[model samples]
Target: MTLNAAPRGLYFDDFEIGQEIVTSARTITLTDIVNFACLSGDFNEVHTNFEYCKTTAAGEPIAHGPLVYAVAAGLQYATGVNDGTLLALLQIDGWKMLSSVKHGDTIRLHSRVLEKKESSKGDRGVVTFLRQIIKHDGTTAQEMTAKYLYRRRPKA
Candidate 1:
């Protein structure tokens, strides 16, 4: 990912329904898989054992699904659109892992604002988005509906 010199974040009031964001690409590597495996303690054969994978549908070791999901979130954050305006991740719904991403696959995040709602007290709001992880070959490897709490724009 290319580093941003000035990362701008959008407040709750700035998001509009139907708005889309496409982030820069990042390539998956064996080191990423190994690090994730060590961090998550999920050394599943599908992700850590290549020899064991030849017997499975993947035919070779693949990155963990959750690792890809995490990467997608990282890609979104790297865009700097939510630098400080984002308060917290409220929820994730309808998450799906449609395909497997392997080492060397370049991926990017596609995020679309689905809806936004103001808090009852007007101090914060929630934004719902449809986020997808798209691989270099144009395949959507994973997708989910993510709801995030965001602070409202500060009044002058």
Candidate 2:
């Protein structure tokens, strides 16, 4: 799905339960894996070593789960409402790593808004969603349920 280029802050009125937001695709390259390994200090052989993978059940080098999650979260942020309107990401629950992502895999994230409610103490409301990270070929790699605090629309 093509995202809006115009910056529109997501307000309480913008989200509806059961609405799905599809994020842009991002491809993971070898350089991305190596760079992520250096930045995150995760030097696990399963992610960085093809030789080690030959002995493991994965049978080949794989991307780190967190790295894949970061890509997915980036997509979620680019959806416009979360980055422009969010005060904070309050909670993330039920995050499951389902499949292995190898190098050169292009992935996409899809988010379904599950609930919305006004916060009692804050000027914002809470938006919660179930997010799915899918491979370019349509395999689901990971999923998460996350909640964020988003600003309410200003009084006109």
Q: What local distance difference test score does each model get?
A: 0.91, 0.86
**Which residue segments of model 2 deviate by more than 4 Å?**
1-7
- What is the C-alpha lDDT profile of model 1 across 6-112, one tens digit per residue? 32788899899999999999999999999999999999899999899999997888998888988888888888888978889999999999989999999999999
Q: Which pairs of residues clash in candidate 2, taking residues 3 or more apart in a chain or in different chains?
A: none
Distance from true position, residue 155, model 2, in Å?
Answer: 0.9
After superposition on all C-alphas, the RMSD of every candidate to the true structure, in Å, is 4.3, 4.6
* Worst 10 contiguous positions by lDDT, candidate 1: 3-12
TM-score of 2: 0.90
The C-alpha TM-scores of every prediction are: 0.93, 0.90
TM accuracy, model 1: 0.93
Error of model 1, residue 125, in angstroms:
0.7
Clashes found in each candidate (C-alpha, N, C closer than 3 A): 0, 0
